[model samples]
Target: MFKVMTGKQAAELINDGDSVSINGFGSVSHPDEIDKAIEERFLDTGKPRDLTMIFASGQGHNKKGAYADRLGQEGLVKKVIGGHFALMPQIREMIARNKIQAYNLPQGVICHLFRACASNKPGILTKVGIHTFIDPRFGAGRLNEISKETWVELMELNGEEYLYYKTPRVNVAIVRGTTADPSGNITAEKESLIVDALHICQAAKANNGKVIVQVERLSTNPANPRQVIVPGVLVDAVVLAPDQKQTISEIYNPAYSGEIRMPHEQINRVIDEIREIDRRAGVAKERSYASMIIGRRAAQELRPGNVINLGVGLPEMVSIAAQERGTINDLIFTIEPGVIGGVPSVGGSFGASFNPDIIYSQASQFDFYDGGGLDIAYMGAMEVDQKGNVNVSRLGDKVIGVGGFVNITQSAKKVVYCFPFMGGGLDVKFDNGSLTIVREGRIEKFSKEVQQISFSGNYATKNQQPVLYVTERCVFSLTIGGLALIEIAPGIDLHRDILGKLPFQPIVSDQLKTMDMNCFTSP
Candidate 1:
């Protein structure tokens, strides 16, 4: 039987220097009360030094009110392992200062690793990290001196090479849901997807670790047995957290997908305004209007009744463009880790945003994505190859592991890639409310080959899914032959702007048109 306790009471299960695996994704689906309890315990006892905190993705409430933020401020964590932590500046500083050990692992690999542990497997084996920095041959997942030994090791199975990702024993597992029945069965229907809470609980149980759950409400009877995601047998404690709120949905008011149905006249007006802005700013070329132009183009693809997910970087800007065009309310916007109908966080804080309407655990969100419930996904790419493969994990010297790009992009019906024509160094000039490119970027994001395969081209082509590559200078679509050029920017000669930069020639479309002119100036 599972006992119901307050957040503080249940958090006492953690001991000093214990390894804790927190179930979270960015700002969505985090255990609030339990996190607060952990912070309180550290402040009161001060015994836990070198505590290991493992998370599959970014964890932390913002400065205003997030559980991870409180814990980081209290100095309760000594080491952290997981994917991205862009949302938690305090924790990032701690890792940068060598005060904590931080390991960046692929988000999908971490989720699957937990599943492997639950199944009593040795470790996870995959080719996702072969040529990237996650491999031992490169920098691995090492972030600081404390993580020198945490590099991923390569192994072979029947002469086939693979990467071995090990999982450590968990002392505690903290999770959240919408409600729990008296039998300790939890459900998160309002969340974007069902997470992997059961797997975490079972893994913790296997290691004799405690499992704590935080929920918004407790039901009088057991929920429909079929809907019970985490059985009572795997749960040790339950905490009622009615006061805890969803982070991202509250910050940005997300419009549900089923509600998006904009009038064609409205869209045209917005496009015209954007064109005027670009023309006034002398941004007649598509490459020069990359950011705003791509935003407008993506907005055109959004349908009224489709569930959509947006990745960080340029994709984040699409929401603003959508909002400006009065189409914000017609589309449902969801973020990975079970946040639905919320504004996405910008820049480094890619995890959770300020306010969200619905919040669920990280595991549940993955279930939704894996189940193929999303209609479309807009993402950013560091490099894309002719085969239509995308790589956002490893660049020349950096190792920012795939956060949730693999899950969301691979599962969505349509994947739109947004990026600049080039990266590295670029100069821009904004004058008289007009924008101009003083100099072009130097780095090449499109290559004959990529550093790693985050989005598999073969898998995409096999499924016959629609993949669109949008850049400042041109737009391309993945075709059976290879990359096919679909559009070109104004004021750019096709050979000079397109063929010269690419490693190989892309099949060109005879119907290629100039980029819209309204992206450069203010409406």
Candidate 2:
């Protein structure tokens, strides 16, 4: 039998110097009530200090002082082993200031590590992080000076190199579900997305640790075994938060829970509602001409019946472009959170799909992705060098760790990197199917060398993967030598707009042609 406790009691169960694992994707499926209680306890009593916090993906409400960031007090988290830190500004600040030890790994690798911990495996041995920052030769996923431990090791397995990531022993798991019974049977029937809660629970139980689950309500009737995601045997305690939300933005949406298959038209309405919410929240919406041009060209790369993954930021416009071309149904869309064949929600509700065909654990989806299941992947790039190496994880001072970029890009048969030619206040105008640059951006995206390699060009080249670099101004293809300029937009001077802006010279294809005019005009 399992005990039912308040959020405060669950928070008290956590002790100092314990390794805690949290389950969530972006803002979805977070045990916010428990997280809040822990924060309150830490502030009031300063108990449960020096926790080693771990998460597979980002868990934030797209704003400060929400979600996992609530537990980011200086003394609360002594170390952080996370896959992504874009949303956790408070914790990231600690890492920047060298106040805490931080290790950044691939999101998929971390998800698989949780499974490895459940089975008492020594570590996860795979080639997912080869030649990237996660490799020992390339900084070994360390985010700060204090993160000196070698969690990742490069070993030779049967003449082939592999990255062995040691799994962390979890002492406590804070998970969330929709419903629970007195026996602690947990069901995620009402949650927006079931990320890695099951794996987290199993890992905790395997270590003889505590598993604290937050649910919307408690039920006397026994939960159906078919619907029980985490069995009672694995769960130790359940906390009831009657006012729990499905997502940060949504209270309850049957479409997100797969209870109802929303009509395609209604899916569009859901997207509109999210955009409206963003507008009201003062989020800066980027509806720019450069993104439109790049989105149209990126959408052209899609093939019928192809399984695709689109990264956040500029790559999100691909879905909108496909919608304009009436080909959204021809291709199957998948997100990193195991949501397949549905319209992916944006902004605060990113990880959840509006009407998904199926939802699996994040680990299962990565298994498919790591096995080369993705036909094509379009990802955003912060920097692209002449060697076609892309960097989306880090900039000068910020360490926006790679979430799923490395896993998808390295395993995909074909990869297309999408980003503007320049960043930071780039302005453009399209006049009657002709492109003109109104204002140049302060920063050039293409450079002599990228600061960090999130996706290795040499690995892609060695594997013979097709790669393309798409921008609003021109298109480049990966060649044996470097990037080759293959196409340029109309009404744009090649040397003045493209060549002059590039820091290093690129191979100009003799058969270079003009970009499709249809991309610039309205759909």
Error of 1 at 302 (Å): 9.1
- State the lDDT of candidate 1 residue by residue for 1-523, as single tens digits: 8899887778677777778887755555667678778777767877455677776776653343365656664357778777766556677667777777778777766777777777788776676565455667666777667776663689889997678888756667888777888778887643333445667787888788889988878889768876677887788898987765554433211222112333545544534554454445453233334577677766667888778888866786677678777777677777775567645444323444333555555556666776787898999999988888888865644445577777677678899998887776554544564334567789888899887777777667767979888876678988887788987665666877678888978888888876554444434
Query: What lDDT does candidate 1 reach at residue 478?
Result: 86
- Please write out the lDDT profile of model 2 over residues 1-523, one tens digit for every residue: 7788888988999999999998888778899998899999999999889999988998886576678988889899999999999888888888999889999999999999999999999789999989998899999999988899889999998999999999998879999998887678899999878888999888888888999999998888999989888998888789988888887778888998999989999888888888888789876476788998899999999989999998988888889899998999998889998888878888778888877888889999999999999999999999999998999998987979999888999999899988889988888888876799999888889988999989988888988999999998999999888899999998889999999889999999999999998788766
lDDT of 1 at 508: 89
- Predicted model with the maximum lDDT: 2
Clashing pairs in 2: none
